[model samples]
Target: AEPDPLITETQGFAQSLGDGVDATPYGLPIEYESDVIRRNVEWLTADTISSINFTPIHALDGTITPQGCAFERHHSGAIDMSKDEYRLMVNGLVGTPLVFTYSDLERFPRENHVYFCECAANTGMEWAGAQLNGAQFTHGMIHNMEYSGVPLRTLLEEAGLPDDLDGKWVYVEGHDASSNGRSIPIEKALDDVLVAFKANGEALRKEHGYPVRLVVPGWEGNMWVKWLRRIEITDGPVESREETSKYTDTLADGTSRKWTWVMDAKSVVTSPSPQAPISHGPGPMVITGLAWSGHGAITRVDVSKDGGKTWETARLAKPGEKMALTRFYLDTVWDGSEMLLQSRAMDETGYVQPTKTQLREVRGENSIYHNNCIQTWHVKENGEAENVEVS
Candidate 1:
């Protein structure tokens, strides 16, 4: 083989001394990795303030998403709020309404837990057909993080819950201009919800509800209000505009399905995808993707190369964690033929991810929320991939 000048010759970075420790006081992705970032579709929403962006999952390998580049959805754009100006109110249906300052929250016993929050509309664009061409756009509206905070149950207990808990609800809202409020069942609120102050061991970013936010494990992202402000105990669901007019799923018959809070089992192949297509010639290939279930942990993930005609189980990178993203991979050889790739996730509850056709038969293409249908990526002999659908 001819001498490879690039590697045989000393490169600039190899011989020259690199920057000092202080080069980056606060760390950031190196210049070479700048392309990996959250991206938004310009036509998806009327304005950027109320728009959403997708995580660059195709370029990422691990499960934990860095807060800096994680997908962000804002109803009124990111706000700048200082900890000193933060206050949380616990009122309504409680025995004593109380207001707590940021300092007060810090004094409480804190617990740390990892959870995944997914937008209900993550893959809604594909309901009709293959719309977005990249894995990020199709399935990157989610992120997993370790949160530190006091469990919401502690605060509710401090405020004194009523003796009869049945039919009770907690209507939580944020401090942002939109105030994005949503109701949660008392059982769920008291079970695992957290008034989180920190994510991935640092203060929440302003874009991600700086100072404080509510972490509702295994539920749709809309219910996990950011810039959390108040938790109002109510006799029943307030049937707020968010729940009725927005998040609710419209059926094929035109009837709306309300209270669809949980995100079902879903998975997508990140590599050999439109944005991260195969670059090497026919040989060994590593197929990888993410799988998660709001119902429980993902037990297994199956990959289909011929578009669901045959199935092969992928190896889980780690044992799936409840309500957290699970990374899966399949190591195999490529024969240089056109391939239709797909993945299906099975949660602990035995709910298998459904196909788009199956999903349409049940919910129809009229609805947009909670579209967890299996996705397809058509890979050509040239190693390029594109969003595609197969019967």
Candidate 2:
């Protein structure tokens, strides 16, 4: 039977306003998608005031998440301060201790790069069953955007790092009430770290470290200190509360793991997932989602419609640069029956994402961070999807 072309046209409407009149000083999502919002798991962590918020990954498309909908995870709510009042102090092992006002930071040579930030605890619930029941809850603790900032290497050189300060580490701390701090090896500090101030072409939102934040590309989000204010070159790691009491994952042997900073490659099928089910009938369906890696660019994404029994390489729409999110598409015709959908990402280093079972076998089930396992979504006959565990 022939498909109804008029029905397809009716479902897809034309843009009412032309591009010129549609421009705005501050951009926002289309009105029809207003309900797509950052969500919080009521009982996942602790209190609402200091808890983590999840990004609506299922509700989003493309590689970028608008700054407004970017998930926020803070020990203390965002701190507010004027640009004049903001100062970044550099002390400790430096040859010359110095403090730079926000204006001073702006004067340094700037750089622009896009990177994805994922809370190590993303998909933490899968240690149990398909617990959260939605991609927004299981896989939403992440976001990607192009940031504008001065590289930390530039600032370190500007402060004249001490000639005798060999074997020294550096600690970057935030100004938020919690004052989150993390240490970085000098090698990484000199490589790609940035003191970012802008996300997605505009000033960052209050929740996203407004005036400034630290961006350690290809590293865990815990080290990307928000509301950044100080850079202290030190002789040893600070062993800050964030690293000691939290962020660090506990092992099955009752000991804890430390400095587990790099976020592994991960991928999730956003559509045909809980928040976005198959609403249209069983023909010419586009299965698309996001894939990323903290170690490097995603080299490949394999999609499975039969719960990993068979795999096909999905096409990357706009394969982004290293350390940025990559969009992938898998076009197929659903037979209007039950199906299990999944995706697996392979990073530049040839590291393939592990399954939940594989992850638990190696890292144990006691961890709360860096849970980058394959996700599964079950589609019912009615076209609704639900989270499920295959193994």
What tens digits encode model 2's per-residue C-alpha lDDT throughout 201-224?
A: 988888988799999898999899
RMSD of 2: 3.2
Q: What residue pairs clash in candidate 1, if any at all? A: none
- Give the lDDT of residue 365 in candidate 1: 94
Off by over 4 Å in 1: none
Model 1 over residues 294-314: C-alpha lDDT tens digits? 998999999999989999999
Best by TM-score: 1
